[model samples]
Target: MHERIDEQITFRRLEVLLAFMEGGSLAKAAEMLDTSTVSVHRALHALEEGVRCKLFLHQGRQLIPTDAARTLAATAREVLSTLSSGIRTTREVAGYASSVLRLGSLYSLTLETVPAMIGELKAREMGLEVDLTLGSNTELLDRLSNGTLDAALLAVSELGAEFQTIELFEDEIFFAAPTGSKYAQHKTIDLQACSHEPFVSLHEGFATYHGFQRAFHLAGTTPTVAMTVGDVFSLTSLVSGGVGYTLLPGRIRGFLKDRVHFIPLDSRFQMKQQIGLTFLSIRERDPALLKLGVICRAMAKRFGIRT
Candidate 1:
């Protein structure tokens, strides 16, 4: 009995009734809704049954509205209007169609990629503002999954189905040592030969950390990690002060210029990190994101991004 009552009072039926009341005829209502006249008439009849009220007078194919229908029409208009506004507000909170874009990125990108991307975005005159959050790839991915971030720039890896990704470039991991270190004199450093060397690393969950482990594992040796820090800046500082050697991406070379020496890894111990832009698949069509995609694609050309 409750199910039957619930089925009758639906938003679709209310919309039909409102359309008929406003358009004043079955033909006009059908035209307004882009439906057939039969559908419009059927909807109105069903709406009346659902409300358990006499909503019209039938006089030779004409539907004369009842006082009850007039009242119902006003209420229907209000209900639909409120629902429309609610949907817009909800989407705004979710970072779609909002004035601000909540963007997340790895701390390493702060040196070059992120700053350049944000500059181009602002210069486009799109009137969209960016709220930047920087952290490890794992932290950024977590924020994206929880709806706290609209999109993220991170290492491209096997991601869940909920994400849409655009690959920007591939960066090779290099051995980073303090200036004038004997390791820098080599054209390509061999990780196996340096197994006894002291190294500083970013903590777990960072892209660089993952690469660091992979390179050593391939070399069939484990590094002597003296310390693990949280951010790339600190990791670089530790390396610069000669605390320990570490593996870093080529992109951060500029940041550690003149302070650290970055040497390529031998082929047997080499690792490459693919950097990309990622967002929720559901928000791929958002206007702000579309604009952001345009800007990123233009930048990707510099790195010869794969299609």
Candidate 2:
């Protein structure tokens, strides 16, 4: 039994074998690889010898590959493709020509904040591509910490010292109910008064979830949660459909204004969420991140969210 493969088998030999397999003739393979037919013959011969198998049938000038040769050629193609992907990923990790910005944010931001930021970024940088990832606040922060995301727009409360943040705006959590609901007439809501009312809430890890918990805690009442959804839009939809009510950030007021009633929470039950641009401290001076910071600040001012 062959315990070890021959050292003569190399990537160059595999490449030559694949080229020959595709071209179907020594002359054609040589032409495809920009080499001499004699060199191609030598490489194929060496490859067959190294593998200790009859890879081709030498019938006069026509050479026909065996099944084994075809299989090896297929495997070689996969190997090369995987290696190419690895090389590209290595370059990305090394920060080489990184024109693609991996930006993460909460699902709620896609309505306006993310779109505006991406549009502004494209205007400033030629040939720049933005990869937007939307998730919960905890998910975005985790991606940022692991280097999976170059930067993220999320609540800055849970950020670590290793990250540098630029606070964009401060948003207040408001009591949300369906339009024409009994609570619509109130200028502000007291969570205690609505303790018995059925409500839908965002799942934990979302920035609004913390606010939901905090407001209810401050109100000294635990709300009756009918359901917990993964995204803010779905939660808002449930509320709009009269399934329940929720506490959501004021930033999303415009998105559901027609369908839902947004009443500010009483002063004692108010929970403020500080939205910001967060990136690794080591990348604070990165040109793309710096430009993003500028865009976020301008967006805050334009939206009258500057704090």
Candidate 3:
């Protein structure tokens, strides 16, 4: 039963008519719209008044679309498509505009994990691009949270509720010094005994330094820090050039030369820290994120990530 032709059509009522026409039943349209069948029917009736025509000609219990109804349905499809395109464009600008994943990582991981992750991402997606940055855990996490970075491989496994993370790997710290330094000769070194040795270490807030703090706490002493630097490589340079002895992550092995020696720790704290990928919880909003997660985990496994 259709009525007057001049009344305005509400978008929802138009959408409902389009849904009913495409879907072929009021019940299915209601389910798709997340509404009750009665509500769908009510809107369809109102749509008849708005358009001043019969949209669906009912046969027994089946509702079939009229020619005019099908025409209107095409217009509705266009509207929905336009809306979707706009939202997708905005997200693409933030993440997908370039094929590259804008990635960040802790200074320590730049030695091994970042390179491996990039290699794996490229192998899995031939010609895949990656734009990478290196920073301390705090800087990388801040960039990740602020949308400047799409995702990060960070060694800071414990952050408050602000971040979402999944395990990438565990990086073990080791006692290291210049090749001929006094402690470098030991079969097993006790850190507490060397508490007076001048040390080079990451700045206090860094994950490596936090591991240092914990390990030294277990040893019941603190090393004398001769110089405080902010990165693993910087600490390595300072140590290798005979600046000071520092506790370094095993990843530093990749950068080692004849200038330094690495001795595995025999400590109560184990001197290990877990590293992982961190992002905003809504990473699901980007399908590419899932692909990145898969790539990150695969690379982590190759690096012998425990979890």
Candidate 4:
């Protein structure tokens, strides 16, 4: 029985069972739980199998709970309530009730932006422990929406309506070429001039990929992309090795200075990637988030980024 419960029973299934008990019908339960009737029916069947009991009677179009079902429902309510209390207590004891801030950002920001932000945050909030996650723009946004991250630093254009964002800085996109390449001699180069050159780009989900697209679109031409890489570092490394040219933000130029030439695009083909801090609108009043927001704004100003 214990094995059966462990394999089949889940908190979501138990919640569904309780909702079914209260609503007395699959459709009603689905409506009350904001799920599909089929999902509620499936959960009920799974619950019955887990407990090895016939908890409901199928009477025409309605489901009537058996005595066993009512008893289990009562037990479930108590169990769920106690579990909730246990979780709350655990959080309090672990000092995570409010002092833990889970922050996420794009992989590109890890080198400088993230470290500086973490240092500033620690200086201001000595008791706060920050858990940082770095991923692609889409992955970070997904985590932010699902409550896995308290806030994220990402491209401002990628933020959705569900988030409230504070613009931190703008990174101008530049054409990166090998140091010895002919294009390296110019302060600014025309996009069309590089149209035939093999280009290395980040995959589709990256904000830099979008910037690359915009630059080419403005030039009214398409690039001959030879390869695609995951992160900015690798893409730049490829450019430095003379594999192919690529588009990247000006900030990375300092590190890749000797290896590659960072050339500004002609005015008509220039693009800027807007970076910002984003969090759920509902968490606007969270004290930790508020403090982080203040720190971000200050850092933006210090870096000469528009507030």
Predicted structure with the largest lDDT when compared to the true one? 1
For candidate 1, lDDT tens digit of each residue in 55-142? Answer: 9999999999999999989999999989989988999888888879999999988888898998998788887899999999999989
- Tens-digit per-residue lDDT, 82-119, candidate 3: 87799788888778544777888887777667777777
* Candidate 4 vs. true structure, TM-score: 0.68
Estimate the TM-score for candidate 1. 0.88
The digit string of per-residue lDDT tens for model 2 on 48-102 reads 8898998999898888999989988998899988988997787578443478888
Ten contiguous residues with the weakest lDDT in model 3: 2-11
Per-model lDDT: 0.90, 0.85, 0.78, 0.85
Cand. 2 Cα-lDDT: 0.85
The candidates, ranked best first by lDDT, are 1, 4, 2, 3
Best by TM-score: 1
By lDDT, the better pick of 1 and 3 is 1
How many Å off is the CA of 149 in candidate 1? 1.7
Ranking according to TM-score, highest score first: 1, 3, 4, 2
lDDT of 3: 0.78
Candidate 4: where is the Cα deviation over 4 Å? 1-97, 158-160, 305-307
